[model samples]
Structures are given as structure tokens and as C-alpha cells.
Target chain A: MKYWGTLLLLPSLLFAQPEFFGYFESEASTMQLGSTNYNFGFNKFRLDVEARPNDHVQIGANINIQQYWGKTSWDVYDFIPVDHPTGQGLIFTIPDTILLDNFYMKLSFKLADLTVGRQQVSPGVGYAWNPVDIFNSKSLMDPSYEQPGVNALRVDIPLGDRSTVSSIILPKDVLDESTHQFTLKSGIGSFDLTATAAYESEKDWQTPLLGRYDVSERNLIGGSVIGEMLGWGVWVEGAYNTLKIDIPPWSSFLPPDSEETYAEYVVGIDHTFDNSLYMLVEYLHNELGVKKQENLSLNHYIFALEGEVNSLMQDYTFFYAMHPTFDYVTLSAIVFSNLNDTSGVFSPIIDWNVYEDTNLSFQGSLNWGDSDTEFGLQDWGLIMNITSTF
Target chain B: MKLKLLLLSPFLLLIAHAQGPTADQIVDRVTNIMSPENSHSKGSQTIITSSGKERVFEFESWAAEKGKSTLTRYTKPAAIRGQAFLMLNNADDIWSYFPRTKRIRKLASHAKKQKMQGSDFTYEDMGGGDVFQKKFKSRILTEETRDGAPTWKIEMSGIPEEDPPYPKIIMWVRQSDYYPIALDYYNEKDFNTKSLVLSDIQLIEEYPTAMEMVMTDNKERSSTTMRTLEITYAWEPPKGFFSERNLKK
Candidate 1:
């Protein structure tokens, strides 16, 4: 029966596919952390299909496959105690199978639009959560609580060129073992706001804000002030969240489990010189835990300076990140080839522009500090990303 | 009145000393140097260095008002067809074309020092800005041998402040063939920031052409641009390469 349904869905998709594109890339790397040496290389192939059936309907999906070859050195995070037979190692949960990345149908008419079936809902800049991005590897070391839900709905109303209001909703376990989320956003200029509420059935879903319990429920509200000042551009965003958790024994390591409220804020400023050099600085503060338990607060400060000397020597940037509260520092250099725009950032990374409307990237970080391991959590890893637009 | 005349006398003398060539004279010389009618008879070149290695790309370009201008690549087909170019010497408004997506976008502003495709070459280096349209006050600095060839040093300052990329520039035009042997750019903030050297001038088909051009930046590493193996001034394009519709096709 399932085979027949898949067959029925195939023909219509063939005629409706918007465009087809593919990209292939292979990379090799060797990492030296203290006395340990780890080397590995992988190649990835991706294909994306998008289609707009009519003025009111659209759909798209993506597929990616990758394989790593050779003896993989386990970093501290992946290093398991030799005594424990359950080796501490990296495991592939979502098989190298033909995984369904994203499948959605959207409808639009005059002042309104709706989307259904496995979709992401993102509002505002990348602050609390950017649902629109399904394959986000920017924070891979962190666990995921939900996979954007298997079903979602969206509505939008335009209030002229100056303003807009949008709302989104998705069901959790409506017909499957999926979670649910809903969000609404509205405003113009620097006074924009977004409110989101979510429910997850697999309470054990590892969402940082709601991770203490199994069945996680959360309410999120965020606001931003972004505008140009003087000849400089500046923006600030503040977000608050209320989370409820079904306590698990392990969570008792540091907390009195009850509904908790947390907040995070980010402020950034940038100015460009007439000579084509620009400097930017940003500060971020995330109250990881509830109000009184703000001891779990994470404060990150970043400073970056970029200059464009000429056409051929397009952009040169030096970036520094200091997690004062976490006692970690990250320094990076980014050079974009003005000649071809093939950009490279120091550190291990998978930078790709796979297709016209899609980009996939993965980068790993080496944790530095003076903890027991001296190497800190040297096992920080990003992820395989897949992005497409229709 | 005598005091005013005395003060103005030195200024007049300085003005006379600063005068170089008229706009029409420079335009006429440039036109004669790049004439499409006689391009087929000319051959010339320069050197190029990239990616820590130096290579030579030899080619010829022919431009005719009503006819077609063809630029053929001898060493590297990727450079010409790559996004490092923005050739615009056509009938309509000059168009800047990028080889990456193979599209021609329009050019705006008249900044004298704006870099071309991020290369050391400016928009003027790509041959879009007409020396005739912009006012210049040039001072003949000296006459010297460049790469063993006699060259004339001329400094040009833009009369209009709001011009393209560079506000002031210096150049060395070969006295014998009138080919530019070198160019320098000076901006307000960075002062003398970039320099371009042209050598190996070859008189192919009767026009002096530089077989190599090397540009250096005082800022970052791997910061250099080289244009070599040039077959300047082509007689004409192959039978039917240029068409109004071909611009889009």
C-alpha cells in the first residue's frame, strides 16, 4: 500500500519540479590536538528539486549523501572509557539511506499564503530559532529537540511596503511521532516582535531550553531594534522563553526542576570606511537558565575587522570571539577571493555553494581551556546542511 | 594692481609648466594605437604572475565601432571567460560584463580609482572611461628609459573631484610607440597604494603593445595581478561573431 502511494506521488512531481541542480565536492583533513593525531576525508553529493505548480502552489525537497573513509581518531568528546564495553563513539542514527530532508506544499492568494507538511518556521533574523533552515549545522555539537515538525501552516498579511504580519502553526504527533510548534510575528522598523509556542511528544528531545524533561513544552518571545545610526549600522535583539520539563534523573545534576524562564540578547554595530574598510563588533548574552539561576548565563563577545584594499584583494577579515563566562576563545580569519569569491575560513570547515538557491556547510571547533583534559571538549563538530528555496 | 600681477605671474608660469597634452591629442593617439582596421597587422604582449607562480597569457583584441572586436586567449581560456573581466567599448552605454555568470551589467559612477573585478586594474584599466570625457591637468615630469626603451613620465590630476576611483594618477608612456609603460595610483588616505608596470613592448602589426603587466598591492599577501601574452589590436572578429542579439544570446 505504501509503495503504491509513493508511485502515485512520483508522476505529479516529475512534471512539477521547478529546476534540477547538482554539486559534488570532496575534502581531506588532518587535525593535530596535543599529542593525538586524527585524519579523515569525505566527499558529498547533493541534488535539489523545486517546483511551482501554479501562481498559488509550490513544493520542494533535498537529498544528500556522504561517506568518510579510513581510521577515525576519536576526540575527547567521542572518547569512551575503555572499561565500558559500549564504546564511546560516533554513531549514524539517520542511516546513509535516502532520507526525506524536506517536503512541503504552499499556497498563496492575494493577501494570504499557507504551507503544510514537514516545514520550518523562522521569524526575524537568526536569534532564538530560524525554523526556515532545516539543515542547520551552525550549532551541531548541541542536540536537537525537534526536526522542524512534519506538518506546518503559515499565514501572512502585507501592510504596505513598510510593514507585515505573519503567523505560523504546526501539529505535534497529529498522525505520527512528531512534535508541534506555532509562531507569530509583526511590526516595522526597529520595533519588530515574534511570539512562539511549541510542544514536543518525545519529551526527551534534546532542546537546551527544555532539555531537563522528556515531554518538553516552551513559549518564546523575541523583539529587535535594528536601524542605521549616523554612518554606522546597528541592531539589538532580546528574547525571553518559558520552558516546562518532565524531569529526568540525569537533569538533577544541577537544577531544581520546575517551569523556568530564560532570556538572551544580542547587540551589534558596524561602520564602513570610504576606503572600503569596515569594522564591526557585537555582544551577546544568553541567560541559559531561569531568572535566579542566571549563573548558567553565557556571555559571548566578538570583534571583527574587514578591509577591501582593491578589486583583486577583495576582503580580509580577522575575527575574535571571547566567551569570558565559559573561559574559551576562538580566533578566525576569513579571506574572500574577490576574483572568484571562493572564501576560506581558518579551522576545519566544509564550505560549499552547492546550487544557485542552496548552500551547505560544516565546520568543527577545537575547544581550548585548562580543564582535566587540557584539550577541553576537543570533539566539537558541525553537521551536514541542506538548504533550498522555491 | 602690480602686486596682484606679481602674485599671478608665478602662478601663470606654474600653470604653463604643468600643461601636458590636450584631451583631443591623447584620444587621437589612443585611437591610433588601438585602431581596429590595422589591428590584424599588430602583435604585442606583457607578463602575468598569480597563485605564487608566473604564467603568460597571449591574446589579441580588435574593436570596431560598427564591426566586431575579438579577443582571443592563447594561454588561459579561463581568464577571459572568467569573472575577472568587464570589457565595455560598444556603441550603447558602456556595459560591464562578468564572465562568471556570463552576464553584462551596466557601469555607474565615475570613480577614477575603482578597482576592476578586485584586480589591481581600475575601471579605466578595462578601457571603459574615456580620457576625453574627463578633464585632466597633466605635468610632464621627465623622459627616461623604461626596460631600456625611451618613456615619457606624465602626472595627471582630475579637475573634477567627484570622478571615478583615483583622484590622482601617474603614468609612463613610451615616447617612441606611445604605449603606456607603467601607471601609479594615489588616493587621499593610503597615499601611493598601488603601481602597475608594463614591459616587453612588441610592435606587432605596427602598434606598440605591452606583452606583460604586473600590479602589486601594498596591503596583503598574494596581492598581485599580471596580464601577459597579449595579441593587441585584432583586424576583425571571425566571420559572424558579433550581433545585437548576440549580446544577450
Candidate 2:
């Protein structure tokens, strides 16, 4: 009863005269593997409210409601499930969840802006991959999805009309200094440049499933640039991370304690032709990634699945193309290749503006490789979605 | 003698008012009135297809250096909100900002031929006010009446080496205020492709300004109407406001 009371009062407390807006989306998807097929359906409803009570203060919030049901051939029961276990079936599950994606208040001053609460901060210039995105990791399968926000306090100060300095603090508990980040952004001539640094305490690291280990403090430095060269849009981004880890004493062929540095970088270019066709190509190099199947063990794969490390191969290449085929329709294609293992995913999409503020999209992805390669274990998939905003 | 001199002064004033401005002077005056040193405006555009489907978009715009540099930001239509375009001083390169991606894209020069926001107006139509004077040579054809006012019918042709979008344009300029009342654009094949009509003339800052404009695409059977909601003249924006930094903001 107390939680319900607070939820009812949230809107009144946030705004005196608020503006309400959001969207509703419904999707149906299917995956094909050999002679068997799996299907899923979901609906998402979101509501957003924003208000400026005065010249110096502003508040905003976003709430998401999702309901989904699916049946798959893969073994998903081995991991912890986010849904309530009410159904009686081996390959079927229904999940329902409600979440607050963003809730923040901003205070504006003469020289700075301060924001507190859950918010999103993305500092990279890459289209398909963003190695410098330290605060939040985005899904490569659906690059257009809105990233989840982080609970933090942020401040931004303007050095001039073309430059800004910003800092963020993510507290784990009261008076904790577990995670923090700082960034500087500026425009030099036609180029937009950014630099970032972050620090995280060791207590935040989770224990791996296979071994007991202690992790030390971690530090990160990253930079990115976006500009035009020879009539083409070009961008480059990179990051370096240093951390110390103490391996289990029983582990063989590994040191008990070691400090390691991992580096990652990406370079990309894009051009638009005379017929309004857009094309892009990008290459990525990740030093922490495995190059061959023999170098990766089941424990390491489990660590990658648990999000303890970046889930990518040593080298990758991406290509994209988009064309407006008609007045109301657009066709696009994307390809992501794991160059180290010679595996890749090819996707084609179509978008149609059916009506005002309404859109329909159909997309499909086909993966190909050997059994041990990156793309071989994934099933071919197709999805159709309809979205409307109000 | 004083009475006789006062009577002759009225006749002298009439003679001065009777002499009309030449064609070049009329074009120059119109350009000056349309392109101020700096200005800001809020407006809405409504596009109507032949099947009677309508879509509306709202925007805010700022311009400096007599329309040599301009910035336009869309504020309505959730899908395109916060999208901005920055064009430098008559440069062929134009920059576009997408809020979702938080990236700036430089459009090629050939993009001028594409439709703007699915509307009938081409990108070239929204370029700037000085496009006509910079690309075409004007000649007065005749004196005619348009929209209940005496107007000069003028014919303008593109320079051979410039290769402008339109081969020729026929314009009707109002005699009283020198504002362009209507324009018909022709392609290289001498076919009329588009027509623009201006209405609701009002005086702001001692200059005649059009509060409403309608553009029609002849081949597509579609039209777009733009209405100015608010306008201010001589409001110079701060320096660096048109830079790439502001586009991201």
C-alpha cells in the first residue's frame, strides 16, 4: 500500500504543468533451425512526462511496460529467469515486467547544468560499435534500441560556446565512490572530438561461475573523433583498460596474480551517392578477443555470456546500405563479419510509413559459419513490428 | 508669390512618385526586404497529397549575414524532433543533425534535388533568399495585375555555366511594395514543374514580409503550405551559434 501511494503521487510531485507523450509497439518474431521453428510475440507500452516548473528547474520521467511469451529449442533454464514461473512446460515461458527507464531532475545555472537520477550518457562516435561507451553497453543486434539508463549524478560546465566539461558519479551505496567518470568534448574546425576517463573499484566485480578470484581496481581512457575527409564522413574511436586480477591457485598455465591492459579501436567511413543511396564500411580490432577456437574454453565462454567481458572476436568488419525505393518505403541492408573466424550475419530490412506517426518494419537476419565459428550456433531469424507515437 | 510656389511644390512631388524603379533595382530591393542582416522565426508546414492526406511539422529557424548562414531545427513530430540543419555562407556543403544517433552528416551537393521532409518543396527551395539573384539574370516582360495589385511580370534565366536547378523562372513582383507575389519554375525541357504563391503581406520593421507561402509540385499533384507563427527581424544570434557544436546541442 505504501508503494502504491508513492507511485500515485509521483506525477503530481514531478510537474505543475506537464506534457505527456510516448509510444506503443507490437512485434512478432520467428527463428528457423533445420526442420524446427520457434516463435515469440511481445507488446511494449511507454509513457513519458516532462515539465519545466521555472526557468532554472526541469523534471522528466519515462516508464516502460512489457509483456512477452515465447517457446524456443535452446536451453534457457540453466540461467536465472527474469519472469515468474507459473506455466508448466519445457520449452515455453511467459514474462511480464514493468520498469522505470528514466527519472531525473535538471537544474540550470549560468555556467553549468546539474542532473540527478537515472539517465543515459553515450560518448562514442561509432555507428555499429562503440568501444568508448563505458557507462552503458548497447546490443549490436538491434543498434536502434534505446539503451537503459544508469543511476548517477551528472554535472556539465561549458568552457565556451563550442566546448564542455562533464563528470558523472555512480554510487553503489551511501557515501560510496565505487564508479566515476569525466569527459571533455569540443569542436575544432569541422571536427567534433571527445576524451574520457573512468575509475571503478574492485568490489563491484562479480565472481565467475567456474573459479574464485579477486579483482583489483580498474582504470579506463578513451577518445573519439568525427569529421569529414575528401567529401566522405569519417569517424574513429578507441579505448584502453588496465586492471589487475588474482587467479585461483588451482588454475594451471596461469599466473596467480597479474596486471593486464586491453586495447580496442574502430575506424569507419560513409558516403552518399547522387541517387540518394547511403553506404558505410567499418573495421574493429579488439585485443582482448580470442582469435581461434582452441584459445577459447567453456569457462571463458561462460564469462563472456555473463557480460564480464566484451563479447566479440579479434577482428570485425561491418557494411551498411540504405535507399529510399519509393515515396513511402525505404530498403536497407546490414552485414556484420567476424573476420578472425570467417563468420558473419547478413540482415535486410524494409520500412514503410503507413500513416501519420505510424510505421511498419520487416527485418530478417541469416547467419552462416562452421560449427565452432561465431555465427554457426545462431538460428536464422525474422521479425515484424508496428509502432505508433502519440 | 508664396501661394504660387506652394501650388507648384505639389506638382513636383507627383512627378517624383510617377517615375518607377527599373527591373534590376526592383529585384535588388526585393532581395533586401527578404534577406535581413539577422532574423528568427517560428513556423509550421502542412503538406497535402492529392489524395487529401495531410502531415504537419513545426520548426524554429535563425539566420545571419543576410541569409548567407542559416540554421533550422524541427520541434514537432516526435520522430524528427531535435533534428537540425546548418548551412554556411553560400557553401555547397550542408550539415544535418540526427538526435537519435547524435551524429552530424554532411549532405552532398546533389541532395538539393531531393524532397524536404517528404514535402513537395525541394531542398533548393529552402536554401536561402539570395538564390535567385545569385543564379539568374532578370528582365522585365510586361506590367500586369496580380492579386488585385499592379505588378511587373519578369522573366529570369539561369547563367549558362552555373547549371542551376531551374532553367527559367517567371515572377510577378508587386509594384507597391516590390514583394514577389508569385513564381513559376521551369525545367531544362521548358516545362513548368513548380509554382509558389505568397500572400498575407504585413509590415514588420519597416519592411514588407510574407506571412504565408504555398508551393505546388505540378507533376506530383501535391502542395505544401507554410504559415509563420512568430517572426523577429534584426535579432542577430550569438557568434558560433551556427557552428557544428550548436547543431549537436
Candidate 3:
């Protein structure tokens, strides 16, 4: 990551238009580990670079170096070795520092665009989906960022002044053990629709392949739509995946009714008060168990609300996700820095212009889950971020 | 200068003896006060606070005459620049234009009270005297001094006299310049909740120019301070700054 950052800075010495943007984040937490509270810190320093030599072509890449300086369980150690001795220690840090998050070359000819190489695939508003991010993906335990799980090609064709059609494809990789994944997206006016399909041979990073879950081959499909109405906006989305598990010798260890197919869907609403304030609410539900109807049916549900106050300050958002069957809630917040120039990805992420973007704020999420059946797991997180753009 | 003052002194004294002008007269004075021909110059600045927040803004203002006006902002790094506000305030009517995402949106009267750039000041503040004509009724109360300067104490109430954002404003104007030096904004409960303190008035070719103003809300711990660091009264600016090409560029 440091080397990539240095290379980007070198361009400043050349054309002086060294388009380099990056963010540095650090998180410290004290988790109530069963009976004891433990202190830990997660630090990440990332660098992103983009270069356009001419109007028709451009290249960009993002590299992040993260250090998980904390304690871990034996299972965590066995999966990904933390630099430490045998026993449970005070520090179990992952020293593999440099990770490539994105690298792609884009060519644009008038209204059309084409991109190739390892890239992040943000699909169907799911937040993080690795069907395309084949190189490195978000840990299923913590879905924050994703890596290219597969090398893919993307093309976007403009249909008219207010419409576009886009598609993407990824080839076989060592991990997925198979070839071919595809996605299609279309947009017109205030509405958008998307669909995806993929075939896998072995266990992909996105899914597990073990016991009855050891899926050597899998196929998936998804669709979504978003549009505006009388002074408000609405969105609808759905996704489904089918898995073929390799029957293993230890079949008795797994549940007898393990399902080979799963599906999820979400619907949302957004309204804007003039141009300054806006409110958005959404609900998401996943089908956890269909093969075993009595055991587990409805997986999880998310309900959230967000709003902006003005351009300079006073933007706030809150969200609550529930597990009705288990009786739990996931609470979250979205905040922005009103003091910074309203620019870049974080600007929209924080809704600075909607109210006052300069206001510094803190967002927190608390998850409540049940202990009896792992249906309701409880976890909480608080974050404070400051941002400015040039 | 002596002749001019002597000739104007009797008219001023007569107006004072008559107990200040009516609400309509006050509105006329305010409207004439901010004419493009009355202001010193036009330029743009990026406002940065002690907390490191910044916003870039530009205005084309005149002192005595009405002319074209424009305001634009850089919303993103690479996206085309867009107009934040545009107005052509003439003697007939005040018109404003807003660029839309897909088309254009025209603003109406009710939007004036909303804050500008999320600051305490509203578009109504920028509207100056336009809304005052129809929305308010004023009467002169007494002679007063603000910050040791002579002023005319005035009482203004919305026509319906219902609770407005600020139900009343007691303005203190400099006797010599006729420019407000300070004012107290009162809420519906008749409490002096907010105040605007204007200072650093310099005579730009015989006009009292306000260099800075700080609006403080006593009820809340919040305040907005604006300091106009420089002013240029030239009629002609560098070419292309106000053109639509530059606005989109």
C-alpha cells in the first residue's frame, strides 16, 4: 500500500495532476468477551490512485494495509494464523499488511464505458457481494469491504439521455474451481433493474463447501428496481442462489434437511424535503431455512431510517433491524462532517449537503441476539469520523 | 460637502419631527439602500471557520442600480459546476432561477425563511426588502443608540402579527449613514432571543458599507459570524466569470 501511494505521488512530480485519494481509519473497542471485557484496536491505512492520460482512457487502483492487533480464539487462529505463540496471548496480530483492493483500466468512448481487470463489484445494493470480487472479499463475519474474487470485465452502454445498459463477466479462478459469472443492469429515468447469474465448480470465497454444505457447484440470480414518486422514491430488490453440495462421508455431522437453495429480498422508501432534508426507510428479509420448515424459516430482517438536515451541518440517520422470531434489534446511525468541503464519496455517504455537512458526528450500532439457538447474537459498535475534501 | 449637508438637513429634520417613516417608507429605503449602484464591488470568497469547514461562494452586487446576479458552487471534484442561486431583481419584480437535476425549478415566496447553506441566515435575509413590503407593518418608536451610535428605534410586526421566525426586530441605524449598526430579533414570546451586530462600516464613495456582521442566538449556543474581508466597486470584472460557460465549467 505504501509503495502504491509513493508511485501515485511520483505523478505529482510529472504532470502534477496526481489524482490520489485515500483514507486512514482506526478503531478501538472493548468487547464483553463472555464474562471478561477485552480491549482491541483495528487500524487500516489505505491509498487509492487514479490516472487519466487522455479523455478516452483511465486507470485506477486501491491498496489497503490493515492490522488486527487483538486477541483471538483458537478457531480464529487455526483459520488465519495470528503472529503469536501457542497459548491465548494479549496480542494476536495479522502481519500480512498489503492487500490489493481494486485495480482496473477503464476506456470511455463518448457515452459508452468498458473496464477490465480485478475490481470490486457493488451489486443489487447488497453492500458487499463477492460474486465478482474474487481476489479478496469481505470476511463473511464482518461485511465492510470486498476484494475482486474473480477477474472480470464490465461494459456500460448509454441507451439515451436518461437510460443505460450495463453488464459484467468473470472467468474461472483457482478458488472457485469453475468458470463464468455474469451480471446485467439497466436504468431509465428514476427506475433501475438488474439481474445476475453465475456457475461455480468448487467452494467460492463467498460461500462454504464443507460437510453437507461443501458445495462444489452453485448458481445464483438477482434483480432490483428503484424509482421516484410523488415527492418520494421507492426501491425493490431480490436475489436467489442454488447450491449443489458434495455428499461427504461424514454426512451424519450435518443436518439432514440442509437446503440447496436460498433467497432474499428487500424493499425501501425515500422522500426529500425540498433539497435540504430527506428521509429513507428500508426493510430486508432473508430466507434462512426452507428445506427444514419447522426448524428455521425466516432468517433476519432490517429496518432503517436516514435523513439530512442541511448543507453545512445537522445531518443525522438511525436504523433498526429486527429478528421477530428471536426478539432482537440492530440499531445503527449515519453521520457526516459538516466542517468539510462537500466532495468525494464520503460526502454523499454522510449526506452533508442535505443539511450541514460540516457537523462532526458519531454513529453507533448495537445488535441483540438470542443465546439459546444462535438466533439472536448481540454486538455493538460506535464510530467517529472526520472528513475534508479538496 | 457643507452645501450638500445643509440642503439635506432640513428634509431629514422634517422627517424626524414627523416621527419616522411608515412601514412602506422603511421598505422603500431598504430596497434603495441595497441597489447595485450603492454597493462597492463584486467578488467571490471561500468561507472557512475556525473548525476547518469551508464553502466557496460568489456574488455580483451593485449599489444603486439593478443588474444581473449569479451564485455558483463546486459540488463535486469532476462534475460540472452548478448555480447555487441566480436572481434578477429589478424595479418591477424579483425573479430567481434554480437548476434542476433533470430540468429547472422556480422558487416561490414561502421558501425565503429557510436557511441559506444551512446557516442561521435565511434566503429571506438575502431577499432584503422584497418580502418586507407585503409581509410586515412598521412604525418608528424612538431615537436610540446602538454601540454608541445614534439610531432610529422601529417596531415591525408581520401583517397578521402572528408568530414569525422572529416576531419583531429592533434595528439601530447610524444617523449619518442610515445603515443599520445593530439589531435585536425577538421571538413570539417577546424575548430578545437573537441579535445581529454589524461593524467596520467604511464609506465607499459616500456610502456606508458593512464589512462584517455576527448573528448570535442567545437561547442556543450557536452563532454565525460573517466577515467580508475585501470589497471592489468596479463595474467591469474580469471577463467570463459570470458567463454560463464558466458556471458549467
Candidate 4:
């Protein structure tokens, strides 16, 4: 009801002749996880509305609806909302959702641009994985998918002709529970250099206990560089963050409160061959990642599944290749390899642009290696997606 | 006197190498005549396949500093709407903004050679008004009749440092207004691969403007025609209009 009210009031907020457009997408897939054969599909619709009242002010919003179909029942052990208590034999099903994906209002002044809203504020140069971005989790199946926006107020100020300084604040509850980030970006000839610092606090981050959370603190500093050398594009992104975790009472292994420092980095390169084949390769190193397949626990997996972490393995290599078979048809494939577990998965995609406003794509994935390996325990799937824009 | 010698040196050089105006002088004049201080144009490009299918894309563009810096935003074909390209640093740098990603990224220099939106226009053919003569050496070949008018036939070769996509080019310029009418691009094997022809020329604001242009790929048997519906050179953009801030908008 609140989303409907917001939808009803959207037009009034957009004063000018608003530019409205969006897309519809549907995907169906069948896969096997462990001893079970699973089949499911999802449909999504998104509408984007934007208005430029004048040269200095702009407003934009995106509303989305998503639903899944297939086996959707679960038990209490599956998980309960933090606000809702669970009882024995309690069961539930996934519900269709309508959400305000993101919205923003920007005012451009002579000195800077002040934008406040749910905005996409990620800083990284690597294509496969952005180590500096810890708030959003990654999907190995579709690494290039859109990222969920974060609620933030950002101010971008131009330092010089080719440099910028961006300050961002993400408020959670009180003032001390907020996340703040500052980045300085500059261009030196053909290279782009950026340095960033952040102080973050996650209020509802889960501990070992269910339906309970403790405030987690992470302080980070990072830098990245992107350049072209010898006709090939190259980039390096990295971050070093201090982590503090509080031991819950339910934990039997008493390590008390623990404090540590962790680091993550990604190095990447891309090149387009003379024949028009585009290839990209990236390598990631995570200091806190698991070193052996046997050491991977449910907690770490859940953390990776949620937004707390990006990867569960120590080292990973990502490779992508794309080629145009015709003017309207593109064939591409991506491989995600875990070095420590000696496991990998590869997905091949065929995209056909059926005219100007629609596209049909098909993807097939193969999970290879022993079941004890990291990626080998995942699903092998085939999917078809159809998208239409308006 | 040394002052007299110094003042007359330019004329001496012109007379020393002249059958008429040198190739560089003619190209410079044409560049100055075609490019203006500030300009904007709204146009549509129709791409025709060899099998007789057509797709139209609408766009509007603004350029400042005599075509050195430019911004072009697409407004048609729902899939590519709100996509924009920006070129700065005297056309030496390029950036692209995609609305879906909500991010602005810089393009490598070699991206200039690729076709734009699967069309016949390369990034080089769209931008870089002054970089043409800077990257190549041009010489007049002959005087010829083209399109029932007298034209100067010229040849251009790429300089070693630039490593241009096309190593050789043959161009025909109208004698009256120094407007370029036709250009033929040749590959390393001396095969004419693509051709661009300018038609529907008009004098707008005392400048010779090509209101319609057709670029054809000889081997592929396909072409794209660009038509300008509205244009002006008397408009000046707001201060700091070419900055990255405006590019995102």
C-alpha cells in the first residue's frame, strides 16, 4: 500500500515532461544442486522515470516488480525475518515483491553537484569483481548484472580540469551508525588514478545466533589505477580494511572479541583483437577467504550469499570472451575458476538482438570437478531470457 | 634587412612549392570554412542493409571550440536511448555515458577505429576536425570534373606516428567553396574498402554545410545515410558546458 501511494505521488514530483521508459525481462532455468533437481523461473518488470526541471536540477526514480514460480515452500530453519519470531513447524513461501529500487534528486551548482537518494555508489575498475566494493555481493552466474543501489547523499566537486573529489554518506540509524566515504579521482595523461577512504558501521549484521545481530565496524582505505599500455587496457583495484567482530554468547569456541585486518585486490587486463574478438582476464586475492574446500563453513557461505562478503575462496581467476557472429548476434562466455579448490564453472551465452527494441539470450553453464570442490558443489543450469524495452 | 626577409619567407615558401594553393592550405581553408566556434545539430541516421532493411536512429549533438570538443546523445530506438558520447582535449580523449550503468567511462584511443552503433561512421569520421591534417600528409593529384563541377583531386597518406585506420585516402573537393564532396578509403592492400559522399550542400550562416551524407561499404554492399533536420552555429553553450558534469546530464 505504501509503494502504491508512492507510485500515485510520483507524477506530482516530476514537474516537467518526464522521460519514462523501462524494460521487461523473464528467465527460466533448470539445474541440479546436490542430490536434488530444481527447476524455477522469474519475471521482472522495471519502470524508470526521470525529469529535468531545469539545467541545474534533475529527479529520477526506478520502480520494480519481481516474482518467482516453482517450489517455493520453506520451513522455519530456512530463515525468519528479524522482526518476526518463529515457532515449531512454521513454514512459509516466497512472496512476490514490489519495491522502489532507487530514486535520486540532484542539484548542480557552480562548484559541485549535490545528489541525495538511493544511488549506485560503487568504486572499482575491475570487470569481474570489485574488491573495494564490500556492500554488494557478486553472482558468478551473471557477474555483469545490475547492482542494487545504496541510500546515500553524495557531493561531487571538481578539483581541476580532469580531477574530482566525491564525498558520500550512507545513514543507517543514528549519526554514529552511518557509513562515510571519500574518493579523489584524477587523470594523468592516459591513466586514471583514484584513492578512497571509508568508515562504515553495519547495524544488523548477523552473528552466530539467529534473529540477533551486533554492530559491526569496518574501516577501509583503497586505491585503483586504470590505464592503457601497448594498446591493451589494464587496471588494478585493491582495499585494506580493519575488521572487529564480537563473539556471541551461544558460541562454544570462546575466542572472546576478535580484531583483525584483511585485504582484497583484483588485477585485470582486456584487449580487442584485430578480428574483433574481445577478451578480458582478471585475478582476485582475498586475505580472509577460505584456504581449503574442507574449511568452508555454512556461516561463511551465508555471509557470501548475503552482502557481507563477495567471495568464499582465497584466489579466483575470471576470464571472459565475446565475439560478434553477425551484426545483430553476439556470442560470449565467462569462466570463474577457484584456484585453491581447483574447481571452476563456465557459462556460454548467445545474445540475439531481434531488431532494435528486443533481445533474446540463452546461457548454458557447466559445473566441473569433484563434488568436494567449491564450484563443483554448485548448480549446472541452462537458461533462456527474453527482454523488451519501451 | 632581416625583417624583410623574415616577412617574405612565407610567400617565398608558397611560391617555391605551388602549382596552385598547397594541399595543406586547401585542407586548412576547408576545415576553417566548415567548422565554427559553436554549433548544434539534430539529425537522424538511417542504416540500410544489403537486403533492403532499414533502421533509423535520432540524435542531437553540440560542439564547441571549432569542432575540437563535442557531445552527442542518442534519443531514439528505445534500447539505446539516453546513451551519450563526449570528446575533449582537442578530440584526443573520449568518454561514454550509459544510462543503464549510470557511470561514465573513458574509452581507449584505439576505439576510434570501430564502427559506431553498427553504422558506417567511425569515431574518427565523426570527430577530429583538425586532427586530419595533423595525422596525415596530403598532396594534390589532379584537377578533375565530378558531379558536373570542377573539383580538386587529392591524396592523403598517414604519418608514421599516428597509425591511422586508413593508410591512404583519395578525396575530391569542390573548387568553388572548397567543400569536400567525396572520399575513398583504401586498405593496406590498396583496395578501396569504404566511400563517403556528401550531397544536399547548403549555405547556412555563411558556411558550406552538408545537410545529407551517405557512407557506403563497397565490399559489404550496405550503407548509412545521415540527414540533418536542424542546425545552427550562432549558439553558445553555458559556461563549463563541456565538462564531465554536463556529459552525465
Top-TM-score candidate index:
4
- Deviating ranges (above 4 Å) for candidate 4: A1-14, A34-36, A72-94, A206-215, A247-258, B1-18
State every prediction's TM-score relative to the real structure: 0.47, 0.79, 0.49, 0.90
> Which of the two candidates, 3 or 4, achieves a greater TM-score against the reference?
4
- What are the DockQ scores of the candidates, in order? 0.03, 0.20, 0.04, 0.41
Look at candidate 3 and tell me the lDDT of residue A251: 40
True contacts kept of each: 0.00, 0.09, 0.00, 0.23
Task: Report how far residue A83 has shifted in candidate 4, in Å.
Answer: 28
Clashing residue pairs in candidate 2 are none
Cα error of candidate 2 at position A260, Å: 4.3
Candidates in descending lDDT order: 4, 2, 3, 1
What is the C-alpha lDDT profile of model 4 across B172-210, one tens digit per residue? 989888999999998888989889999999999988899
Q: What is the per-residue lDDT of model 2 for residues B107-161, given as tens digits with 9 covering 90 to 100?
A: 5455555667778776667766676787889889999998899999988898877
Q: How much DockQ does model 2 earn? A: 0.20
Q: What's the lDDT of the predicted structure labeled candidate 3? A: 0.45
Q: What tens-digit string does per-residue lDDT give for candidate 2 at A1-390?
A: 524523643675465698788889999999875456778878999887877777777677788999886762334322222122344322323557698877777787777788887776666778777777766555556665776667778898878755778898876664444678888988676566889898766534444333456555668899888777766778898989886776767755355676769998889988776456888888988787777756765444544554555554578888988886665678999898888878789999998878877899998989887656666556588999999987
Off by over 4 Å in 3: A1-17, A74-96, A126-150, A173-189, A195-203, A206-215, A247-252, A255-259, A272-279, A289-369, A373-390, B1-249
Candidate 1 local lDDT, residue A26: 55
Screening candidate 4 with a backbone cut-off below 3 angstroms (N, C-alpha, C), the clashing residue pairs are none
User: Candidate 2 — which residues are off by over 4 angstroms?
Assistant: A1-13, A72-95, A173-177, A203-216, A243-260, A299-311, B1-30, B50-52, B68-71, B82-115, B122-124, B129-176, B181-195, B217-221, B234-249
Best lDDT among the predictions, by candidate number: 4
Off by over 4 Å in 1: A1-9, A27-29, A32-35, A70-97, A120-137, A140-151, A174-215, A248-258, A271-280, A289-367, A372-375, A379-390, B1-249
After best superposition, candidate 2 residue A363: deviation in angstroms?
0.8
